[model samples]
Structures are given as structure tokens and as C-alpha cells.
Target: MKILDKYILKTFVITFTSVFVILFFIFILQTVWLFISELAGKDLDFILVIKFLMFAMPRIIPLVLPLSVLLASIMSFGDFAENYEFAAMKSAGISLQRTMKFLTFFILILSLGAFIFANNVIPYAEFKFINFRKDIAQMKPAMAIAEGQFSDVGSYNIKVDKKSGENGNFLTGITIHKKSNNFDGSKNVIKAKNGELISNEKSNILKLVLNDGYYYEDIIPKKYEERNKIPFAKSSFKKYIIYIDLSKLNNTNNEDYTISNTNSMLNISELKYTIDSLENNRKKDIISFVDNSYQRTVTQGSLSSNKALNDSIITTKIKNPDLLSNFIPKEQSEILQIANNSIINTNYTIDSTEQELESKTKVINSHWIALYDKFVIAFACILMFFIGAPLGAIIRKGGLGLPIVFAVLIFIIYHFVNTFGKKIAQEDGLTPFLGCWMATFILTPIACLLTYRATNDIGFINMDVVLLPFQKLFKKIFPSQNQ
Candidate 1:
């Protein structure tokens, strides 16, 4: 290796390392702020907090790594250009491409490493992070029930006005909403003047003993007309006890934890498998629904009866518009009621099926987006480097001033576009492939343009290209003295 190549590589390495550490630390703080609610007001040990942060730290790499590469590239190359080092190299017949050769190779290797990290490390971290989060609630039961807000624990959403005991076990103004098993929303409400939390470290159940409480449960009527009455059972109690299961909350070690249902917790292979199974299940569901709907709404007997009715009506000189006239009055009323009920039921079924299918489709799209994100992170490293290196060279400014500004602006645009694309893709507004690569596609051309300009020694922006038309328009309107 030449002395110059070594110098360039060393310069970039130092800058990249510094920038990466700073950005990574900043992002870690941001993550803490984002989840501060989970940490705050909860008496958690220091070791558990450290574990939470450690598990969450890796997921920030995709965001931090690219920005680091970008900022470092801009700073290092801008410093070289600013100091006229590039001029010395150019005079000695060292082109920009020749200078970038070693750095480019390094970035390619970094990109590959980024891909491996995204596919393996990030997913593992996400799995551990989520399970760790759930484990915290079980480890410290008070964490599961925050003061003054509803906290979902097992099948109940518990809220307390205040907690006062040493472990924050004694509660005041406790309210609990027991979630329905069939997603019918919370129909049972339990309110207490005060409550006490009792738990054993070795046991998986937390007992909530309430005093001066009332249990109110709504009783849904089977008849539609009776529903408007809103019949409910309300009972006052001097004391009530509720037991919550914490057994399944901290199953991080279970072998079945590998098949976590969240899109972020799965690697590329698992995501692919899950997506395929979900799509196949959706297709099967649709087919079964269609078959069931067909049998319910359109039967061979109904078809024949309808054909006979139509034939009889056609034979008359004036076709009877009132088809129900052919039936007895009693049968006519029964037919009308049955048809109305069938139509209502079918409409309800259709709406439910549509919603279920839409949900399943969104989940599938999310999996695809997750799969594509692994590759996107890898590509982003190279893309950011190309953009930053050229931009730095063209700008000819170094240090934390202009380079930071440019890097921030470019990175913000990239982040915004990526988020927008992911949101659209998750909602099925765009295909996952296009959505995941949208930012990359948008920025690649800009990178190429910047690289070309830097290579040929052109300015970052051609002022004439932008101002020439305006200059011509002014000349034509004002009839310039020279003209």
C-alpha cells in the first residue's frame, strides 16, 4: 500500500469511529427517552435497566451506522479538499477514483457486515428486547400497573390513582377492566376505593386485594331489541380479590420463543416462512368463506324455486310485480322476515371477512417489508458513503460546521422518505419491494450526479443551470443595455 492510500484510509477510519460513537450514543439516549415511561416510576434494579438498554442498542444500528458513514465521509474528504491535499495528489496524477479505491473496498466490506448484522443481530436483539420488556413486568409487578393509567396485564387493564408502599404495593382509586375473551371490548369493570398488591418472589401469581369495591358486568342480550336496555349486574363488595397470572409473561428461555409472532422479532428466513403460511391461510380462508356464503345464500332448491316463480310470472299477461302474492299471508310474512335476517347476517359476515382479510394482508406486507429492510440497511451504507464522499469533495469544507449541516439535511431526507415508504407499504398502499427501496432509488441518482461532478471537478450545484433561465427572462423583459 502506498503512503497516500494508508493516510486516506487512516483518516477515514478515525473520523468514522468518532462519528459512529457519538451518533450511537445520541441514539441510545433517544431510545431511553422513547421508552422512559417503562423505566420511570418503576422501581427497577440497575442491572435490569442495563440489560434493557443492551438488548435495545443493536436495533439502532441501521439508523446510526449509515449516518455515521455519511458524516465521516463528508468530514474526512472535505478536510482533504479544504487543505489542498487533493490538489497535491491530483498534480501527482492521483485521480479521485484512485484515491477512493481503498475506502470503497472498505465500504463494500462494511455493507456486507451491515447485512449480516441486520439479518442476525438485530432480530435477536429485538426478540430479547421484547421478552425482556415483558419479563420486567413479571419481575416487578408494580411495573405492570402504572399509576393513573391503564396497564394491560394478562386479561385485565389495571389503573391506580396512586401507589404508596415501599415496593409501591398499596394502591388507591384502583380500577380494573377485564378484557373479553372474544375481542368484544371490556364489558366488566371493577372499581375500588383502595387496593393492596400481594406477591411472592417465587410464585407466578400477583394478588390484588380490593376494599369497598363494586363489580359491574354488562350482560349482553341475545335479542337485538333488548340490547338497547343495557341490562347489567352491579354488586357492591366489602372486599374482593383478583389473581393475575405472570407465568407466561417471562418465557424468554422457552424454545417456542423462537417463533415470536412480531415481524421485527423474526429473521429473513423465519419471516419468509411466516409470510408464506399467512398468505396460504388467507387464501384458504377466502375460499372457505366463499363456499360457505354460496351454500347459505344460493342453494339449488332456491334456484329452482326462483326459476319456477319467474316462469309463472312470465306466463301471465301482466307479470305480478308482487312476488310474495303467490304465497299464503303467514308464509309471506315468514319469508320476508327470514330474508331480512339472512341479508343482515350476510352483510355482517362480509364485513367481518373483509376486515379479517385486510388485517392478515397488512401483517403479510409487514413481514415482506421486514425482510427487505435487511438488504436496505446494507445498501444504505454504500449509498450514504458515495453521497457524502462526493458531496464533501465538492463542498471543500471540513470540521463540524458545514459538513454537519449537509449531513443532517441529507440524512433527515433519507430517514423521512424511508419511514414514509415503510408506512405506505405496511398499509398496503404500495408493494413491499418498492416501499423498502423507495429511499434508495430516490437517492441513488443524486449520488451518481454528485460523484460525476466531483470526478470532473464541477461544483456541487451549477449556478448557471438554475439562474440562466431567470437571467434570460429578465433580459427579455427589461431589454438590457448590452442587448
Candidate 2:
């Protein structure tokens, strides 16, 4: 590298590193703010909390890296412009693009790094973060029950008035509500004087033992049956035990329950696989629905129990009303009944087919959208560098004051567009490719324009100069109007 290139590149690196560190801390604090409520009152271990913070960093890195590129570019170029370095370079025949050569290469390498991180580190981190949360959910037997609140453990809701014992295993004044099963619409309510929690590790069961409790089950009367009195059961017991399956709650050994195919947890290759599979399924389902509907309509509408009736109907374009009117009264009634049956069956089939198609379409859109988002971080970082450097030079200012403000404003626009486009894509409103790259498409031209203006030493915003002519034209058109 030349001496000038080395100097400029070194300055850019120093500013970039500083800005990245500051942004990392800010994002970490934001993470803490978001999840503090869940982590605060749990009396969790310090080491686990640190691990939680570690797993969360990968998710934040994707968001913060783009912003860092933007802010760093703004500061570096803005500082150079403010110090008259560009003028000196212009005198030496070094164009603005020439000055940015080394930094552009550096940003390209960073984009590659961002892609690797998104593919490898992000998927693993997402898996770990979500798995750790599930483990924490089943960490302790007492963790299931909170003081003065109902804890939903499977289908049972257990509420406790107060907790005692060294590990919060003993409770007083407990109420248990067991929700109705599919066979019955009656809920069973239990009021207990005291309770104790016992964990059976061998069987992987959590036994909730209640003492001095009364169970009440209310039965609803059937409309077709006459009852003299309300059918209910009241039972009093000295002790009762409710068994909860710890295997389901822990979910460590079960891949079916623990692992997910959600878009957030898939890498680029997995996303592509999912998209292909979903699209294939959607096509097959559509074909099947069409075949089923056609078969049902033709087969059900035939009265001769043969293909001859269907062939005649299709060949002659025979109307069912006309055919029924020519028959005697009884035969006409039978023909109308057959036609009505066929119409009802066709309507049901169509409704179900529409619902199935809608569901598959949503799944296909999800996979496509996820496939598109895999490139977002890498592309965003590279794009932001192009945008920020030229904008910084145009503004001719540096440091946290104007640089940060401009960075934030541009970042907000980028973020809003991305989020809005993604939301629309999720609902299958636009093609996945277009929805994912909408922000890039909107901002690329502006970046090119800014770069051109900065190279020519033109103002970023000269709206008044252009608007002055229009104002004069309007005045000529209506001289006495508002003014």
C-alpha cells in the first residue's frame, strides 16, 4: 500500500473499532432491558446469567455490526473532510474513490465474515439460547410454582398463597384447577390446606402432594337427558398426589420436542431445502385438490351409476334443472335431491381445499422469506459503508454530535423499511426476494447519488436552489393568492 493509503486506512480502522465497541455495550444494555424481568426475580446463579449474556451476544452482533459500519464511516470521512484532507488529496490528483479504495476492500472482507457468522454462529447460538431457556424452565420443582401466582404445569394450574421450606418445596393454602378433558366439559377444583413437592428422578416425575384438601367436580346436564338434580361429586381426602411428567418438561433427550424447524433456527442450506420441499408440496396439493373436486362433482352427479350419464351431461351441456323438470313428480324430487347432494359435497370440498392451500402457501412464504434474510447482515454492512462514507464527506462534520445523529437517522429509515417489508412478506403480500431486498433497492440509488455529489464537491441538500424557480413560476400563475 502507498503511504497515503496506509494512513487513511489506519485512521478508518481505529474509528471503526472504537465505534463497534461502544455499540456493542449499548446493545448489551438493550438486551438486559428486554429480558431483565424474566431474569431478575428468579434468584439465578451468576455464572448462568453470564452464559445467558454470552448466548445473547451472537443475536445482537448481526444488528450492531451494520450500525457500526455506518457510524464509523460517517466519523472517519467526516473527520477527513472537516480537516481539509480531501482538498489536499484533490490537489495531488487522488480522487474520492481512490481515497476509499483500501477501506472498501476492508469492508468487503467484513461482509464475508458477517456471512460466516450468520450461517454458523447464529444457528448454534439460537439453538443454545432457546434450549437454555427450556432447561431453566424445568430447573427445579419449586420453580414451577410461584408465590401468589398460578403456575401452568401441563393442564393443571396450581396457585399458592405462601411458600416455605429451604427449597420452597412446601406450600400452604393452595388451589388447583384441572382443566376439562376432551370427553367432558367439567373442570375439577381442589382446595388444599398444605402441599409438598417431591421429585422422582428415576421415573422423571414431579409429584405434587396435597394434604387436607376437598375435590369438587361439576357435571353439566345433557340436553337430551332429564335430571332431577345437578350431577356433581364432592370428595374429601387427607392427601392427594398429582404426577407431572418431567420428561416432557425437561425435553433434553427428545429431539422431536426440543428441536425446531422454524426459520430462525435454520442456516442458508436448510432454508433452501425447506423452501424447495414446501413449494413441491404446495404444487402437489393443488393438483390433488383439483382432481378430487372434479372427480367428486362428476361421480356424485351421475344417476345411471355409469360413465354414460357423465358423458351425456358434459357432451350435451345438460342443465340439471331442465333434466329434473321433464321427469314425473317423484322422479323430479329424487333428481333434485341428487343434484343438491352433489352441490353440497362440492362446496365442502372447495372450502377444505382453500384452507389447505392457504396453510401451505404460508409455510412456503416463511421458508422463502427466511432464505432471503440469510444474506441481510452481509449485504446491509457493505451497503451501509457505501452510504455512510459519502454522506459523511458531504456533511463535512465529525464526532458523536452530527455524525451520530446522521447515522441514527439513516439507520432508522433502513430499519423501518426492512421491518415493514419483512412483515408484508410474512403475510405473503409480496414475493420473498422483493420483500427482503426492498430496503436495499430503495437506498442503493441514494448511496450512488451521494457518492457522485461528494466526489464533485456538491451540497447534499440544495433544495432551496431548485425550489426558488418553482416558487417564481407559482407566483406568476397566481400572484395574489396566499402571499
Per-model TM-score, in order, reads: 0.80, 0.87
Which runs of model 2 end up more than 4 angstroms from their true locations? 200-203, 223-232, 251-257, 303-321, 463-483
The CA-based lDDT of model 2 is what?
0.83
- Count steric clashes of candidate 1: 0
Best by TM-score: 2
Show model 1 residue runs off by greater than 4 Å: 141-198, 207-242, 250-259, 293-297, 300-349, 464-483
lDDT of 2 at 240: 93
Q: How much does candidate 1 score in TM-score?
A: 0.80
- lDDT per residue (tens digit) for residues 89-162 in model 2: 99999999999999999999999999989888887788877776666546678777777877777778989998
lDDT string, candidate 1, 1-483, tens digits: 899999999999999999999999999999999999888766787988898999999999999999999999999999999999999999999999999999999999999999999998998898888877767666776777888788888889999999988888899999999888865442999999998989887787889999999999988888879888889999999999999887787454454553356889788899989999999999999999999999989642243334544454345454366777766576566567667878898899999999999999999999999999999999999999999999999999999999999999999999999999999999999999999999999999999999999999998889999999998888888896646
**How far is 310's C-alpha from truth in model 1 (Å)?**
11
The ten-residue window of minimal lDDT in model 2 covers 304-313
